[model samples]
Target: MALTVDKLMNDERFSGDNVLQFLLYLPFGILLLVVRLLLALVLWVASIILPNKSGVRQMLSTLACWTFGVYVKLKGTRDPRCSVMVANYVSCLDSLAASHVLGTISLRKWKVPPFFASTLGIRNAAQFVRKQHFAECPSKPVLLQPEGGPTNGKGLLKFTDWPCPLGNRVQPVAISVERMFTNVTVHGGDSRSSFPWADALWFLCTPVTVYSLRLLPPVERHDDDDAAMANNLSAAIAEALQIERTEFKWEELRPRGRAPPSRRAGGAGDVTTLARQVKEVLPAVPIHDILRDLAKTRSVDVTITNFLEGVTPYTPEDTTEPRPSTSKPRYVTPAPTGVFPKSAKERQLSFQERKAQMIAEAKKRYIEKNGLNLALNNC
Candidate 1:
């Protein structure tokens, strides 16, 4: 079976890529098993000696340096060591790719297979945390996949009811998955799988699985402000990954009985959530450009100083007395003496020129989008 657009679009598990993967991996399964054992043994020993997250993280990061022919491109400053990495859940390969850049400690679900149990699992490097006690303390940097589970890596899931359990000093990370051999980007699909074991094997066996980690600036919390921190981090993550923020909770969006209170309150909560989530995450900070666009749309100069603080720096001018009719709302005639187009042919030329310019601008924008997607896919 040859890899085709039909298969990729449909995302069948037994696509040509998977067949190639099977052939590539089956021959080296034993070698991979041995390597996994060695890595697990080393990690197990390190974990037994180092009871804290920092020590484990240090060991894992060190190990990542020696293994895998993978491409790990990390972008951003490393700071606030005690910060939870709120990253997008792509595939099982996330930890290994992430481990290459920094030491990560996860307080996720405690389900590690028996073979690598010592190095992984609740009792190992990643502490086991139940839902009730997810983030009871801020003692260490907890690796959190706020999406609850994996997605297609192209979309984002809604942040759970409680996104920030570790309380601020939040570092938002987005890990984009791209397989070099086949252009099949892994995530949640039938032709592919999101299981950690499968992803790990792919990483180890494949020549180069590109993992682009974009670490946005950390959000510092002065007090117990979890909601603000979660919103800010999630919105930043969404924007960084080029995905939409799922603001409405699932139940709230479902068609049901009388709906919720906030729905009845004219979605005030949703407005507040979006406003609080808005803080510049774009490269070079295009807040000025955004404000300019907004001003043009509203026909009013925008003065939004602090987006995160939900502060509207400019208010619309009051029209309390209705402004006494202004200038009678009449169109003035075109200046006949100026260098304006006089003939129909000249006017047609001007219109065509403007039309061409508009088409050129549209093409430029479309090209930019395609380029970004290519970059995201690590092409």
Candidate 2:
């Protein structure tokens, strides 16, 4: 199968592409959306009040899933001993559906309301922690989607090596979603990553999305290498889902709008060419300064961001020799002789004034270093 961005991403909108269809669905979708939000609020409150994994909590969660138009059908036996679950990511709510059925906590890094996190079975944990941590805790099996991001459910993205930290024996849970009237489950456009809450909103707006979850038997690590093990796990899940595994990575899904023209073309290109591009954006910035940052960042947007954010320190270019970027801000060494402020507020104000002065001085120095003043004089 051809592996284009469109093939991997569901580029379709929730409302059909046709103007008439979108207009017809708009009013009803909005009304249905409001009702679903209310139900979600109730579920959130219930999750907080009820005990963890209790019958009431589980029942409310199941009912919430049904109410939100997420119907799940479970198949195959889950290994009771496997604490870590490797699953294919289809939607942002894949974790929620897995939590409801398999009682697994999806590992996440973002901050969510404590109650919501618990209700959704989301935990913020280190990615490289030992498997013993997961193995001892059977109540909360950690689910790792090695693909790192969502796909259009047609193919599996290359599995990352992140799951290797979580033991050898992993229960592979395959989640496949079927949307009524629309094939699109996850919308793709310019978003760098999938937002769970945003995707959940679509779940409520849609007529119904059926999730067919097949829990395969636990896969043990026969291979010694981590990469080999990850590949083996990917192969197992891909075979179960009946989808071809591709070399396409999750990063490929991200829009390259932020990337430099050269980077967008495919390669980083020559360093001098990249530096000149940054120079075009910031003429006052010296060539050496731009080159120094380009070597580190290797992206036009990031290098420019660093300069704008004052993260990169400027070194005066003189004597035809390049100076390394110093961690010490140039303003720190040359302290102005003045009486120290006694009050906390006064001290803060004084600091701000000094910072402003520093910025002004840096700008003046930059102009002088690049001979911009000479150009202005000539003009």
Candidate 3:
């Protein structure tokens, strides 16, 4: 879809780019985070004590959202007649805010406890039924996200048709999330790597996250074509949100050539450790440059290879002490005395030649040690 990594994910939103600024805010942010979390928890408990449909319960929920630094503003009126609402996916809080205003039950299937279901507007689906069951029973208004997953609010992902057939008239809601104090991403784009819990934690860390939802008029379905209906509704929501529609799906939002979070080793949790590993292989490469590539590739070997192959361009930083080449013995062998490489291409060629020479020498030593030379002469 020609979508860049930045469009799908905010890789540098909370980045420790400016060491001084991060250091200055770390202590204050943590303190505010703990205080806000406690207040939100108390409010949530109070809301649970009240009746579900009670106006007091909704007010308590609103207070809880405020405590959690989530501010929601609703623009258009929700159609009471339509029981199905479709919105573009952005964050976990989308369901929370929608539930707060529209009182809709989220059908996005979050694997959390029932206790958390009230707060998140999510339900855990058992093996037998989930959204399908909700679609059948039209008791409460059901909220479904046709994008299937979150994206950085730049554009709209192609919608899925599963939510289209839930109701004859689907309500299209355009949701936009913005932050205050710090310019953080509304949602972490990669679903495979980022979870709802992580997003919630970041929410507490940030000062405030504002959600603006515009409820469009109900989209009436004439033909029984779910795909066509979904597409038309998607275009409508995109126009309302003033964002372009992309052919990109949620699955395609993952970083290109990157491994899933579980498979990502050193760089997954501790990127600095992975950068150090890359630094060991390419001593001339800067730590920041190594970290940048590791953030994208999330692998020490891949970052090192990127530096060695010149796939990632960087100017060599001056080193106080010269270090020996640290490339693996199998892939790269050391050159003879006084030999040096002036360029990446020459260095690679030299390594390959040295590796070949080493292999040939190993073969000769094996033949000589095993008396194969004498045997060949006899033959």
TM-score of 3: 0.59
The residue-by-residue lDDT of candidate 3 on 1-379, one tens digit each, is 5556447665455544555675687798799899988887786577567666547656766776766688889999888778878998877678788888877767534445555666666543221133455556554577878786777778988896755655688889999988744433444434533346766777887777889999999999997597899998999899998888888766555554666545666434577776776787678898888888765554454355456555678989987778767874433344466867799999899788877777766766777788774443232
Assess candidate 3 and give its lDDT.
0.70
lDDT (Cα, 0-100) at 347 in candidate 3: 89
For each candidate, the alpha-carbon lDDT, in order, equals: 0.50, 0.70, 0.70
Clashing pairs in 3: none
- Candidate 2 segments whose C-alpha is farther than 4 A from its true place: 14-27, 126-136, 183-196, 255-379
Cα lDDT tens digits, model 2, 1-379, are 5667557776655424555665687788788888888888888778777776457757876867865788889999888778778999887667778888887877653456776666666664532233444555656677878786778888999887646645678888888988754554544332322245566677788777889999887878874576787888888889999888898876567443445334465344467786887777767678888888766444565466556545566754343457867785544445666887899999999888878777767776777788774443232
Q: Give the per-residue Cα lDDT of candidate 2 at 138.
A: 54
- The predicted structure with the larger lDDT, 1 or 3, is 3
Per residue, candidate 1 scores C-alpha lDDT tens digits across 203-293 of 5555556778998888777764556676777788888887666543322322224445345654544333323323223222244443543
Indicate the worst ten consecutive residues by lDDT in candidate 3: 123-132
